[model samples]
Target: MVRAENLIVKAKCFIPIPPNPKNILSLKSTITSLMVDKGFEPENPTISGPTAGDAGVYYTFTACTTDPEGDNVRYQFDWGDGSVTTGWYASGTEVSLSHSWSSSGGYVVRVRARDVYGAWSGWSGLVVVIGEACPYVYAWNGSAYVLDNNVLVESEVSNGSDVEDFYKLEQAMAPYYAGDHFSVYSIMLGEFENEHSFIDMVRLYAVDHDSSVKIALTPDGQILTYSNPNPPVSAVDNYGYDWLSSLSEIDEIYYQGFPGDYLLLDFGSLDVSQAAKLVLRANLEWKKETCIHVQTLNETGEWEDAAILRTRNRWSTIIVDLADYLPNPEGTVKIRLYMTGVHKIDFVGLDTTVEQEYTITEATLFYAEHSESGKVTLKLLKSDDKYAELLPGEQIRLYFILPNKPADKNRSFIIQIEGHYYAIQ
Candidate 1:
């Protein structure tokens, strides 16, 4: 129950001295919208600054307020960790301050304003979130994604729940078997400066598969190579229909043949436009220097001799270059096998070699991670695209293609993969 002008009251008394009245001391009190007046107070200060910032970095904040009585005002800041009071400033003035946090977390910043008359305003608060200075990384395990620091990574090809090793090479060369020739390897990131670090912009290098019948690698980088051997989609022979199923099979069972008879093999759609080399691969059992004439149909639909195969008394692999016989490089390739004498045909297929980029009719590359929920497909990381993150307790799976079972018992092939990742701090 106070009026505006009578919010507070005060009194003053002066006492005179005998000798020096002019030096008399006086007690004074009054209400001139001053400390004794409780009706006027400064407005609540408002805080303005960043709501989120990195730890260990200094950030700026501003506080401002207005006083009702036109009195000078000063600001008090509760930085959440400590309190700071600033010098006096004119009413409606904005005061700026800077602060930093040592660790990462959320903090509540508060500010208040007080006038020279000793009237204070209510406090204003703001929330700020401090983040770490670096980003986090995670890796894909055979089962699930996990932190990179939780498991030990190996350097070789691994099987089962164990983390697959990095920088391991595996090769397969079996010309005698159907669908069993390929080389594969894997890449992983095991060494890092910090547990929370990650990498990106990875690239792979390698040589072509046709440089030699064996696997070879350059010193500068590992090689990525694959072979595509397609079997005849359909087969026709004047002799019998029972042996047509055996034309594409690699087992010991063969197609019994008659002298001077011919068998035609039709391989479905093929892409030889980018082929480094095209060859007809076949397995035949011959006796006594007997020969088979590899032929192709010409524009006139007549059988033309392509190559002569000569082998004796054993099962031998025959490789004939078909480059000169291709009529349409991107269309289906058909061939005829004409025997000069009685022989057995075990298997026949067309093998294509690629030097650089080539389209895959079927998926030869596969990536899988282990988890209680079974295997999951992860995004393929590329140099110019977004990369993957691996956290602790996680592992990477091996990259694999088609399996290889060599016709020659001593044949071995190897595929290698290298991963390069740059950690962002």
Candidate 2:
């Protein structure tokens, strides 16, 4: 229980030794309106700051509070690592403190505030973790977000979690038997980060069926690659029955075809606007003299031609950039594929690509499609010298940069891991 004059009595001894009578009177007056005398504690101080960092490296933590009675205030800190603050700090005007943990683990940071009368506020708390790794934190350094590291290691991910990160063919894949096509609007990798990191390799993975693949990457940073892929239906829109064809799938490949007969390839939503670049990709199969045509919807919602099949008699593929065709450049868009003749289409796919920025010394691009039958486990080296295992369908992406120069637009390769083969065009 506190009374106005009671504060004056409690505060008397704490006043400067042999305090001047006038000074003591002034202190008594101020105590009358102090936050503690009003029966209120300083609003519990708040802690807001990064939750992770590397040991022995300075990490800034923010502490904030307000005194209801508007008294001048100061703050005290408990670093949670057995470190003590020098003393109470002037906090009515501003507040923040920097600390470095001595070891790796989690810590609970506690802070509190005190009014001019020396009335202590309730403890405010925050939790932070320290790591033994070099890349300690990811944050903005005023002008840009920086990944703290001596040698930057880039990273990227896509597990068909969203079409914006990675796009695929129309939810329905029944039109032609061998050679069909689709397009994807991809964004520049740097857009996701504050800046761009060099690209090293492009990896692809698929399920069910494999054939010839061809790709063309245009200098415009538009991805033009080809492969015979039927991505999992799990990547389809989380909602909607608007499939590529009005007719139901008959065999996942065969469809009735005729002149002017068309099956739409829905790019759906690329989920990006104003992308600095595009990744136009597809999968197709063709026989001699048989052809298919592809088109994209523009910002104006108009369908326009994007590409034409050139499979000579044997099956061929084109996994390349369609620089001339930008789908839903202003928002989300879908592509349409028209059958120019009665031909059996084999495999067709569309994927979007974006570049990335690095934060560590090095990063390994990893991917696994979501499915009902099984799961894929991804592993990464952790700060504790142990491998960290990631559950299936968690993160799907590859982050890397070419060693000497920029990744060649004309570059191509094939990678195989865990009984799966990836043809990068």
Candidate 3:
């Protein structure tokens, strides 16, 4: 019986067979296709901001690429500052990385991608400049005036409108940085009664050629921060003199009163190293005394009248001739405005001209081919009169955003101007 059972089991068993040739070929073909060393080249990467910046700043770069075999990928970056990032990430998705240069220079940022199969794509690159940032901010030599006279007053101002009030106020600035232009200001004279009503005369001190420039914005710093809140408000708040508070009591500041009262305004300190000109403004319909006194602190600390305004009221914009007073290339100086001789204290405006930033859109630059093997000649393109209007010693920090190439620190570039020779610092 056991022998019979064994024979039956053997009958049921059969030999195992090999796989079919077509099936084996199909499997092999799939494996071979995956092994192929192919990866899609990454699209050109992009930077977050302008291609130029100051050192110690970080820049973000992004990239997106695909793989022919749909394999996961990793990115490698050469940040041009001896720094690199070799990190793996998903393919066909956007990836961003940030890097900062340690020193000021021109750098080539290069990037490439690799797949899980170890196939690498070609490199993409960008050039960035790391150095000084250009500024074209408002540069002015003007100061505003609002009076609060409660006591007797003594000023370099010649005539007194009314002598009973002590005054306090602020000096603001206004200036245009273009070709030499003129501005006007006026005071409303009642029936032409006070024929000599004028704004103050402002004189600028000379600036040093190598001194730093001072920047004054619209309503730079007013005196209200150190004084009272709930300041006097009148019916004529729209004529310009208006201060509400700066959020929590830091808003604007203005002045008001009939003729015979005066206000003294202090404009703090300003660096006038590159002052070009000045102007003052006011809004008036009628005037009694009609005078604005502008004075500057001399090197000896004595206040001297630098400008006076004589006008017929309406809307006035007056030029403060700084030809003799400016080019003050030294330290900061103080300015003051004495306002009197009007029924309502509306607003006063001051404008001063200072060195401005070099702009390619507003101006242009010209360069000559490499003079020798490594040197080039540069000049301001003054055909449009934008750069030609700039005076000597007008400092500008330039930024160059272009493809980075090998540069030698020993090589120097020359900048030529029509009226003066410049020494590179």
Candidate ordering by lDDT (highest first): 1, 2, 3
Model 1 alpha-carbon miss at residue 112, Å: 99
Instruction: Report the candidate with higher lDDT, 2 versus 3.
Output: 2
3 Cα displacement, candidate 1 (Å): 99
lDDT of 3 by residue, 102-213 (tens): 7654466777777765557777765454552111111122322111110111211234331111111122222212223322211110000111111111112111122132
lDDT of 2 at 124: 76
Give each model a TM-score. 0.30, 0.26, 0.26
- lDDT (C-alpha) at residue 388 in model 3: 18
Predictions in order: lDDT: 0.50, 0.39, 0.36
Clashes of each: 21, 29, 63
Go through the candidates in order and give the C-alpha RMSD of each one to the true structure: 28.7, 21.5, 24.4
Cα shift from native, residue 297, model 2 (Å): 68
Give per-residue lDDT, candidate 1, residue 197.
Answer: 22
Query: Ranking under TM-score, best-scoring first?
Result: 1, 2, 3
- Lowest-scoring 10 consecutive residues by lDDT in candidate 3? 186-195
